[model samples]
Target chain A: MTSAVLKPGLTPSRVLIYAVLILACLMYLVPLVVMLLTSFKTPEDINSGNLLTLPHVFSTLGWVKAWATVRGYFWNSVAITVPAVLISTAVGALNGYVLSMWRFRGSQLFFGLLLFGCFLPFQAVLLPASFTLGKMGLANTTAGLVVVHVVYGLAFTTLFFRNFYVSVPEALVKAARLDGAGFFTIFGRVLLPMSVPTIMVCVIWQFTQIWNDFLFGVVFASGDAQPITVALNNLVNTTTGVKEYNVDMAAAMIAGLPTLLVYVLAGKYFLRGLTAGAVKG
Target chain B: MATLELRNVNKTYGSGLPDTLKDIQLKIAEGEFLILVGPSGCGKSTLMNCIAGLENISGGAILVDDADISQMSPKDRDIAMVFQSYALYPTMTVRQNIEFGLKIRKVPKAQIDQEVERVAKLLQIEHLLARKPGQLSGGQQQRVAMGRALARRPKIYLFDEPLSNLDAKLRVEMRTEMKLMHQRLKTTTVYVTHDQIEAMTLGDKVAVMKDGIIQQFGTPKEIYSEPANLFVASFIGSPPMNFIPVKPAGGRGRWHVPLATDLGQLSLPLAAGDADLDQRELILGLRPEQLALAAEGDSAVLQARVEVTEPTGPDTLIFVTINGTKVCCRLAPDLAPAVGEMLKLSFDAGKALLFDAKTGERLARESKTPAEGSAGNVAQFRGR
Candidate 1:
């Protein structure tokens, strides 16, 4: 009776398709279910029960300890990811508007150079970026990590926004110009209002990227300024400690929850924005 | 109302590339409607953009009220344009789109509301003021686009094929509305379109352009009746003007083309042209409406077999062979002819135009259109 299933005599291929879809969904969600169950269990319960079993007498010891250990660094992650996402997305929108609309000589070559940055490996810029950060006396600080994430995230954000804005009619810009709107006014009043879907995609993408980033966080920051990802890794891999699997699961859950929440809340818009060009109005 | 003039304006995208607009010259009187018309890739739209200051001309001056505005930006130039796409701001309501320019100029809030009200009422879009452009139909969007321009009392208006996107019924309705609006406002306006019907029905002055050059600039009647060259004559008519290749028969500024007939070839006398026409072949230009069914035992009629007949709602078309060229004659629907029947067609000898076969220039340059009291018709016609 459902609308989406393949109909008309229930062919063998349809059954095979439904089988594969269900199997893939379980494969993805199995580890997440295990992590959530373990995070709510005691050390004894985690060791005794299997990955799929419910907790034997629920406990809060792992979550409390994990929260105590990573709360400061969790706040540090917020400080870094929030500013990086906002600044990078804002700057990318402006960059895209200028590059696509008010083009001058060599703008194409300049955009080509910017696109080159998108494919460059993060390891390729680690040394030079660190040296520059050191020269500016921002090394080993949360500000340094924020700067690094913003710089690295700009390539994708600009790409998303530029591709989105190109579909907008150029006549809109010309009409606004004839209506006496200047550059920033046109961008803010005319263009930006129509960019909500793309903005959602960029924000969701940058939140997940910056939140899960280990390379920039571990390299450019340390000590009191380390983000939650670095703290989670430290908690899981400490050499002179007991192997607390429950605590490690709780910490991992803490580090992964923000991205999960973003995808769950705004996932449909993200998919729509990605496939916007596939079908036209 | 304002007078707009362009003195030898030229535009090129790059140095070595061919010019997109070449040495354009136009002078429009106060409150006159000038229509720039041509096929696509001609420089009519480019000329409109230059007048709106959206594009910078490579050379020459644009005079508005006899003061040069070539260096000003689009906002400073005080001109508004309606794009062919009706580029209504997708994010703004109709009222806000109409009020955008006035708000940018820092007009008072009360004055801006009044201006928006006046323009919305004039365009009959007061019902759509609260809705977005995407919510309206194509014709409604077109009205909102016009309202956006009319809200600003600029010196001149530039319309770049504003009705080109509408359906046939809507385009005709909007065309009549456009004429009424222009008459009521009496604002200096320059419109661009490739539709020859729009050029004929809506312009006080029309400029037909091709290949970055103004082919002919005159009134619509002059453009229709007496074109300056072969391109203008051919491009300005529906079903097009027929051109027949013929050899001249006489000399001493009096020429006639030899047309092939059933009995034999007959000399069709045209206006007096120079002896140079007799030295080379000539192209005879005639419109479909100019030819009619010959009366019984007409002395000067050309005889040919009707090859095909098309019965349109208003008029029937008769196709016949004239000097080995297929020519169409428009007749009353009641006067339909059968195929393969012998038909005699008579045309006004004086209305026929002669052009050089090689150069496409009009041969009778000195002849002008007849005045109201004069019996002189074609021999006294003037050309650009």
Candidate 2:
């Protein structure tokens, strides 16, 4: 009926749009579903004539073997990612606050130079960065990878925090100053508390970037210090043994789970932070 | 309470540019409430920022309680301000917003709690203590802003058009509440507003500024009755002071202004006359209340046809033309005249003011006693 279309219920156009959206979602989700099913499948079931079908017999052997193989690299990724995310986010926050609030001569040019870092491709900097890391006595170590990620990640994190904090009213800063709050007090009490959403966005972005990084892990770290991403690559491509597709799938899922969990946990704030126009002039 | 003084204050955004504030000078005694009123772009907010140490003055020293604080930061200046937008901490509850200043000062937790409760009860926002700023209405946010300033017993409080964002009725109510609060606290304060009514009613002293210059500074009564220039006279009144061009009549010693009305023309005697008056054109500044309904035997009455009538509850404004300039005459609602009808209007010659037509300055006048009934007329007009 015409009333049905006019009311809050679905119309023909709505159904069409929903159908397209569902198709797109399913297309994107197929790989994740296959990875999850294969991680829980025995090697025999994976090779059977049912690539798209659910596992007829479930097994944890693939997961057990994958965990045993990549556990050390998994811990290395954790060690490299946590410090990189924290240090980059903190430095970005201070840089953002100064750039937005305590502007001095040539601050805009400085921010522009920092923004230029975001556009520089890793391939362009790889050789020089490795040389610099060797001179600094940090090459082929997890610490070297941490240093690289923090340095590269700062450009993106600083951009996010600066744009976010620019939307905060200057009057709030002035008010806090009048209330006897000096630099750090104002930052800790007024600005930082109001920065929860922006921090979520920055932290999540940095976490995912550092966790999923493969080139930095391979070039800057070695056998004992390489992150899980590099180890997973090596494990999957090694042609010396039987092709353990189930084990490779399980290791890939393990490498991606942390970032997926972070997105799921803080996705609402992520969206709001992306769109909030916090203050009017 | 403290005396605040600004000596030869000057501000310019950059070299080779016109100054935004020019050699401003003002002084407020302890516990005095000074209102800075002007139209938009008048540098009133700029002046407020200079006084609050939010903006450094390019040229002078600002002193509080006889101590020059020009070099001190805003926090060290020991002053509080209420911004026009309220500027409440969005993430904090009302109680937390009020306690923020004291907390920053490292006040004890017990004292902070007591001060928060006191201001909440004083502003009648106790029920809203746990609510965030976004959850509150505009008026509630305004009270929370005021409460934040009030919680800090600073040397001076600055309010930069705090009630400007409120609706008309709420503005009026808050205006009264502000006056009452000021009376109770007796704290030295400077308030900036564009509303003339607020300037007239709330200020112990009013400073009118325009184009970055202080046009006049005095009590409200002096500002209304003895304005120093044409701009001050024109800016301070509602239904603004009417200006009619007039030519001098009679000899130099005894000047009269000839005004054209519906009844041909009439010459109103000037209270002050000078030898140079006959050679220069003049403007006559008259408030609407100065023009009244003429009695039957009134000697100096000008007849004019009413162009329009606006009844504003307590009184009616009748618009008429004299010398081709539309003039508004405030009369009681009972005397509402019909449009296009001729009415006899009498001008109070003793209350009339003369301005130089060329420079917009008040012409020198001979000393004369103040008008008797004008005070009562001003009271009646303001009572509405």
Candidate 3:
């Protein structure tokens, strides 16, 4: 019995951790369960029935209507998010490689400015940036939303790549240089191959940020190009008609699926990168 | 094979920072192994970086085969370096790690495979070829790191304490393997280490460095037998050479040094005409192996009380007080002496060295061996 507690298979510490994890999972599942139950109910049933009770009849009507209500905006969100994450991560990796390896005057200052931008409040520049987008004829378009997300995500993506690149031994770079690899060769062959873990974090982080972004879409996207976040707000706020709680909850779940799938797929790298950064120094 | 030269190389971290490597001028012959030995912060690694083109020299030219390579990028410089941390690409299998350089250079696929096989076999790491660096032991990782360098046919190789992370027994094994590998390849290599034994046994020429300056550069035998100053003497040996202080006594033609110990004052004969005799105060340099228990009459025997004895399987180190300084004597294991016993010791006077007590420079002299039984009953005192 004592040995059982000492063994990792069913140790007391392991049992306690498992219990807490189960509780946390239930806590997270509560809101999702409520949303799912409400989505299956008729508008009156959603307002009048016990939330925990099983429905006498289940229907796909809520999903059908939710798909129709904001389908264009959901497609727009995907269109903007995909390109924005790719652009931000690509540019950030290049900047990170140069900053980490090369020693030039003002390199420190450049990095300092980039780091400073990461902590700046998004609201502080929103008005002026929106005005600039208007002047540049990028306002009220999917491109405009993409630009905003890319700008906001650049600092974080660059930091991830920069820290990862710095951990690569300088000797490897030198060896590559002696082997006739120039700047691009070293990046392509050495740094890039060694950076899978960091890249996974970058993609997952920037994808989630761009997908869930409400402010950028609300300010920049218009009409047919509005993202799911903006459309979901519209669906909730249209006061002239009866509010459809079932469709609203279903639409919200549909809008959240992309980020959740990405998180699950890349969670290993995301957590590993974070823990490695803490200990590698 | 190529000759390399660093002509007045200078490296400073920043504009106002003190120079890490200052006006370092060196020439390494083709197919020679040059070992850089120094304490930490002595810029040995920095020098290796400059040679590998990893660190840019602030001033001066680096020439390979008499052509200036100072401005050449590391890739074009044709040098390979094995780092202190091994720096194995953690994600790559050992086979890929060895193939990386060849792949970068666009070597033929079939030939790359053959070269990898060769190095893996040579380093006896063929079995680890499929494993990642993390899965292998430290000693195995070190061999893979060396295999990576061996896969490249660069003009020179730089090793920065490559075996420092291994266990003591493995380090000794690798040290012998490295010597044998160097002998076979005849490659021009620069190895940096603080281990004096490695420096002594590995290099064709060893440079003793201190605070960014090369104190002396010569064969290990020369550096050992004729050290440039007190620092080299103190730094180069295990159990280090003992430095005993003394004052010149008696008149001309018969110079003697008065050693004051807890046992009593005894006069040790100095080689006549030793230049440092004029200085009055001098330091006597003796290797621990040179001192022995005096069993026969000897002219220059000094009596001291043994304080401690350490017995290893091969030899025993007996510690005694001489001229108020603790001196260690390496004696055969069977010739153990008791603690607190008065022991008369004899040393070959011909091998005795005298130094300036102030400047610590060696005093020039022709030393004569002590005549057995000529200096009378001094060796008869095993009395205590």
The order of the candidates by lDDT, greatest first, is 2, 1, 3
Best by TM-score: 1
lDDT of each: 0.87, 0.88, 0.83
The sequence of per-residue lDDT tens digits that candidate 2 reaches over residues A83-114 is: 99999999999889999989889999999999
Cα RMSD of all models vs. native, in order, equals 3.0, 4.2, 6.6
* Per-residue alpha-carbon lDDT of candidate 3 for residues A1-281, written as tens digits (9 for 90 to 100): 88966766777878999999999999999999998988887877776778776655786788899999889888999999999999999999998999889857999889889988799888887998899889989989888888888888889998998888787777667656765678897788778877877888999999998899888888777788889998999987888788888888889989999999999999889888776556663
Model 3's alpha-carbon lDDT is 0.83
- Predicted candidate 2 versus true structure: per-residue lDDT over B1-384, tens digit per residue: 899988888999899988998877878899999999999999999999988899988998898988999889898888999999888998899998999999888999999999999999999999999999999999999999999999988999999999999999999999999999999999999999999999999999888888888887777897898776788889999899999998887876688988897666788988775557876888999999999999989888898899999999998999999998999999999887888888999989988999888888776566632233234212110100
Ranking by TM-score: 1, 2, 3
Instruction: Give the DockQ-based CAPRI class for model 3.
Output: medium
Per-residue lDDT value at B39 in model 3: 98
True contacts kept of 3: 0.62
Model 2 earns a TM-score of 0.93
DockQ of each: 0.88, 0.80, 0.55
Q: Model 1 lDDT vs. the true structure?
A: 0.87
Sort by DockQ, best first: what order?
1, 2, 3
Off by over 4 Å in 1: A1-15, A278-281, B365-384
| lDDT (C-alpha) at residue B112 in model 3 | 99
